[model samples]
Structure formats: structure tokens, C-alpha cells
Target: MTLEYLDYTIVFLSLGSSIAIGVYYGFFNKSKTSEDYMFGNRQMKVLPIAISLVASQINPLTIIGFPSEIFVFGITFGFHFIGMIFVVLILIYLIIPIFYENNITNCYDYIEKRFDRRTMIFLKTLFFILGYLYIPVYSYISSQALSFVTTGINVHLINTIVCSICVMYTMLGGLKAVVWTDVLQNFVMFFALLFITYIGVTEVGSFKETFSRASDIGIFEVNTNLDITSKNTIWNCFLSGVLLFTCLIGFNQSCVQRIVSLPTIKDSRKAIILFFIGFIITVSIVCILAVVMAAFFNDCDPLKSGEINQSDNILSYFVQKLSINTRGIQGMYMACVVCASLSTISANINSLSCTLYKDCIKPFIPNSKNNNLIPKIIALLSGVFLICSGFVVEILNSTAIQIITTSLNLVFSTYASTFMLGFLAPRIHSRAMFLSNIVGFIVILGVIVKGQFFSGRVQYEPIEKTFSTDC
Candidate 1:
């Protein structure tokens, strides 16, 4: 179990391949224009773009945090996948065609046309703020997981080194490089998940034992709570799942960039559907993995026994303990979490730089356009912000999933509701749209300030209790 030569080799190859992909694109497939740099000149294919879309969102949180979320909360969390249907419908029929037909580079461009410049700016501000909050937390989560493997390294050092590599590929290769890199990272992520799950389930004894233990312990208990403020309710998951994904696909500029990068509306719609299928498959693995974890530790319950006090540390502990008999998986697990962080950071900074150029810079600096250097410069500058902000992430006490989902859900929900109104209710006036955005912002901010800050650490009671007889 100490990460052996094979382990380190796997980790290095995973990281190295990501950087090499960037180098290939950076040198062989240089971006010739702003569109080329930002959207691959809208010439990209459906599958890679779809995979990149999935990979962009699948970070350490998805791999590390999601299982813990399901194990602790309940299997009802899977109900959120139901919301993807609404997400795809809106994107395919209501959203993508507009962008494709108009040849819009930025999703917010339509906002400016339909509403006003100020509304577009407001959404852009929220987008950058989200990137700032999310990328660092993701980096910190990766460092924490890797710390379990590479025990000698400082957390901050791990984050900086990995992120620097991500920035190098992203800056040189542009959108094309990031997409291809994501395609590679996505397979690694899935395989890692399945590999760990198989090892864990086998340790627990058998497939039937794992499922039986989970059921007997009520890890499969259903949550019926309909209150929106209540955490992890079937109602809330279903609703937030819909809104969160819709916003992610519908309005979030990073994801929107993926949709707009395709050559035609037909290709864009194909990507959207494929992204949904990919998303369903990923979540299915996480759900099964969570149940498997519950069964593997059924007798000794790591969280309750105080062996792994933190919820997020449970997987790391499981991997560490099981590695004694199995061997070599330590590096694969390391690659999984590290690549998760890399995919997330690369995609966000890449599109976020474009967000800055299109919304923030081009509007004010008239000469910024038709300049390939400016986009790369903006991407480089964003990378600095990405790394520096990560240093602040370790200070938070909550689990990575809680921190990310709370802030992201609040913002995305607001943006989802506020922005969708533009297309759904086209007759609405500019002033009305602006006021709607302000109200949505105020409301979401209130929820965060009151629910997250002032309240004594809010905890949602699990639907079913987990008992460890041996412990």
C-alpha cells in the first residue's frame, strides 16, 4: 500500500498524457483566430465535445464527494438524474438552436440582445464569481485526496504543481486541447470508479452481501420531505437537479461554450443528448459505489468508529486499508482524483477566459478583438487567479460536496430561473428582466448568508441510520 513504483508510474502517466495532449494541440493545431481559440472555430465533433462537457463537471467532488453524499443522505440523491430530462429538453428545443442560428459566441450575447447590457454584465459577474469559488475548492479537494497517497508533500504544493500543468495545456491548446484532454480524463475517471468499486465490493465478500447489507442498514431508505430548505429530500433533489443541470447546460458559459462549439444545430443537439446519457452513466456508477461502500464497512462503519472521522475521508481510508491485500490501486485512485481536479480546472479557466474576453474585455477595450494573443493572455491571467484562490480553500470545515453544492446550487438555481425567462417569456421588457435578476440574486444571497453562515452548522438527518455491530 505505500504507493509503489507502479502506482507512481500510473499517476505520472495520467498527468503527463494530459500535458502532452496540450502540447500536441498547442504546436500542431495552433489556434488561428479568436473563434478557433475559444470554440475551435465551431468545427468540433459531437462525441469529444460531449465527453468534455461531462468531464468538465466531473471533478474530485463527483468522485469523492458524491458517494459520501449518497451514503450519508440516502439513495434518493439518484432521483436528481430525473431532472436531466428537463435539462436536455430546454437546451435542445429552447436554447441551442438560438445560439446556433445566431452564431453567438457567448450565451450571454442573447441576454444583451433580449434584455440589456447591464443584465448580461450581471450574469457575467456571477459566472466569474462561481469560477473563483469552485475551481479552488476543487483543487483543495484533490490535494486532500492525494495527501492520503503522497503523504510527504504539502497540500498547497500538490495543488500548485498539478494546476500549473493544467494551465500549461489549457493555455497552449485552447478549447480544442481542453476538449481532447477531457476525453482522456473522462475514461480514466470512469475506470477508476469501477476499479475501486470492484475491489471494495469483493472485500465486503460478494455482490449479494453488499446489496443486502446496504438494504438491511437502510442506505436505500427513501426521503419524502418536500420542503425546499430541507437537505437531500427527494423533492429538493428532483427540483435542484432540474434547475442545476438546466443552468449548467442552459446558461453557464463554460458548458454553453461546449454546445456552441459544434458545427451545426444538429451536431449541437446530438452533443446535448449524448451528454445526458454520459451523465446518467456516471451517476449510476456513483450510486452503486456508494451502496458498495456502505456494505464494505457495514461491520466497522469507518465514520462512526472514528477510523475516518471526516465523511469525505471514508473512501481514502477504504482504499488505504484494502490496498494491503490488493496492491497497485493506490496509484489508480490517485490518478482518479488528481485527473478529476485537472479536468475541472482546465475546462473552467479555459471557458472563463473566453467569458472574460467576450463579456468583460471586448465591450470596453475596443481593440481587444481579432487578437489571438489577448485571449491567451486573458487565459494566462485567469490561471493565476485560479491557483492563488486555491490556497484559501483548505480553511473551510465542511465537506467539499457541501461547500460546492450549496454555493453552486444557489447561484445556478437563481440564474436558471432568471435567464430562462428571456426565451420562455420573450415579451418581457428590459427593465423587468433586470429587476428579476436583481431579485433572484438578493434571494439566493439571503439563503446562503442565513442558512450557511449564521446558522449553527446545519446538518440534515439521514433517512436511515447506519449501525456497526463490530465497532
Candidate 2:
């Protein structure tokens, strides 16, 4: 069969498998109670939680766009993960203390307890916004992957279809099913990474050959200067990455819900440790894969050739190259891409649903503690609304995507300072906590906006963006 036929076959096969899995999860593992739905009945094992963490973090962007970053930038960007290690440490020592101390159901619960009713409501509302808004980035990634393996399909159209599939399953099964499905996706993820790594190494000859090629292209660099102005520098990585990841992992409802899955706080701690190990391994594998792709395609630059304008297109380009050389590998490659996209989107939907139920709808529902239907209804509605929001994003010509992505990133970032002030600083009144968070949120948002909009005028080169304009 021709490569085009094989590509079509792959998408068809993937869609079939996705539907089958969703149906099985929906029917067999339906949630019987709020605890069962929200926290997997609080009986989660360490391995599943670990796998879920990896699944949550390894979005299609990380799989597709990240390797592209490594290819275009260099191994220096590995420092981002390095700082992530320290961020996990911060979570363990700093953030987890409050979580364990308070026996919190949602991360935002801490804000309500430490601050006031207004603060709690506001913060939870903020997270609801953050969660719903972030859906499009996953949609964008899925659409891009679909485009890679299909012909004559619009990317936005593919995104909406994929988003609908995800919302349908998540709305049907709730969080437990999502976690169970994540375990399977995590394995698919590992297999996918290993497959790409194998193909890349074989294409480049060997490990030594791959490293030699990467070195020839100047892909490895270890710089010690801690300058915020220098992108990917160790110092800037320490500052920005610590802040970024603390919010991403510690504060994110997606990550929080997973950690709270275990039976006890101690088990939660164990899951966090396992998550750190899995996170390191998963990130390291992706980095190695990125290097492999760079070496294998050392002479090709699609942007330079005007084949594509964005770094995100690199994975499709590489996959097409592999399809030309092998039989059916392209099919497996596309399956991996779809699995990555589906897993992350599934987790996001699950978490978003949980937040809406616990923080938004539950408070209003009379005797919500006794009536579990409220949570289920809220979860279902949240998924439906977010899918609509995804379509709205598609219509707005990309602004919806930007707002969703940036709002979540900034909201998650404040999680670090919010949790720190609440847990670490003693004698902080609810008034103080409220005032500090408001002040900090405004200040941080201003800084980020100024940096993004007036970056050319200020000429302040952040460590992560130092090399962004080089090409």
C-alpha cells in the first residue's frame, strides 16, 4: 500500500480504538459516588498516580513541539526540566505540608480556609476560568496531529471533532475512568517515545554517531551563568521554571486531583515521589528523542525551506520522513500522537469537571454533600461548556486559544505564591492573604503582559526567550 493509504488507515484505526476505549470506560467504570468519581474512591495505587502524572505533563505539545524546541535550540533547554526537579522539591517540602495538614479536597480549599469567603470564591472562580480556557491548546495539538496523518481536512475542524470525542467520554465516565485510561495511554506514550528514539538512532547510525551529529550542529551546551536575560541559562531556569512548575504541578487541579487519589496523606507523598521519578524519566526520554530527531534531520530546516512557519510542525515533518522509509511505522507514530493528545485532554476535562462541581456548583446545591447528582451534573455540564468554548476559540481566529493558554499559565503561576503565603507564613490574616494575593496577582500579570507586549521596547531578554528570535 502507498504511504497515503497507510496514513489514512492509521487515523481510521486510531479513531476506532479511541471510540472503543471510551465506550468501555463509560459503561463499565461509571462513577457510583462523588468520592469514586472525583478521587477514584481514594484507593489509587502509586504506579497509576505516577503514570497519570506523566500523562498529564506529556501533552502533544511536549511530544511534538518540545522536541522541536530541542532541535531548533539545543540541549541547553534541558535545564527547564532540571529546574522542574527543584520545583518538585519545593512542592514536597513547602506545598504538600499544607495539603497534608488540612486534608484538603481541592487545592483552592486552602485559600478559602486561610483567607475569607470572598477570597475562596474568587480563587476557585479563577481556577474554573483557567481550566476551561486551557482547552484549546490541547485542541490545537490534536488538530495538528490529525492533519499529519490525513488529507484534505481542516485543522480547526479536526480540533473540534477531537474535542467532542474527549468531552463525550469524560462526561460519561468522570475522573476514575479518566485515570484508568491514563494508565493505558502512559504505556502507549512510552512505547511511542521508545519507537521514535529507535528510529532516530537507527537513522543516524548509532548513539555515538547521533551525539557526533548533534555536536557538529552545536546542540549541546552547559552554561552556568544565572542571568534572567539569557534564555535556557541555569540561573533563569531556576527562577522562572521554579515559579512556572510549582503552579503547573502543585496548584493545578489536574495534578492535585491525581495526588489526592491515594488513601492517605503519606500515600500521597509516596505518589509525589514516584511522580518525580517518572517525570524525570519521561522528560529525559523526550529530550533524547528530540536530540535524535535533530541529528537524523540535521540538514533539513522546514522553516528555512518555507514548508512550515512554526516550530510545532516539526513532528509531522519528521513522521512523514519516517513513513517514506518504513512500513506502518507512520501508523504507530500517529497513534502515539493521538494517544498523547487524548490523554492530556481527558485529564484536563476530568479536572475541570471536578473543580466546577466542588467549587462552583456544589456550594449552591442544597445538601450537595448528600446529593451526589449535583457533582455529576456539574461535571457533565462543565465538559459540554468547555467543548463549546473550544469551538468559540476556533471561530475567534486564535484569540480564544491565546486567552485560554495564557490565562491558565498565569493563574497557575500565582499558585506558588498563594500556597507559600498560606502555608509557610504564620500570622497572616485572611485579610492579609486576600490583599497579598490580589496585589501579587496584579503585579505579576502586569509584569508578564509588559514583558510580552513591550518586550521589544524594554529589551529585557528572559532566559527562556533569549534564543526565540534568533531564527
Model 1 residue 41 distance off true place after TM-score fit, in angstroms: 1.0
Report clash pairs, candidate 1.
none
Clashes counted in candidate 1 amount to 0
Alpha carbon lDDT of each predicted model: 0.83, 0.71
> Can you tell me which runs of candidate 1 are displaced by over 4 Å?
363-370
Residue-by-residue lDDT tens digits, candidate 2, 1-471: 135666558656665665666677567756666777778777888888878887888777777766876776667667777777787777777777778778876887778788778777767777766666666666666676667556557776777666666666666666766776677777777776788788878888999999877777667766676656664566665566667677878888788888877777777777778877887888889999877776776666565667677666777777777767776676667667777877888887778767767766676777655455655566566656755665566565433224544675578656666677777777778887777778888987887787567545654221221122222
Full-model lDDT, candidate 2 = 0.71
Q: How well does each candidate superpose onto the true structure, as a TM-score?
A: 0.95, 0.88
RMSD of 1: 1.8
| Highest-lDDT candidate | 1
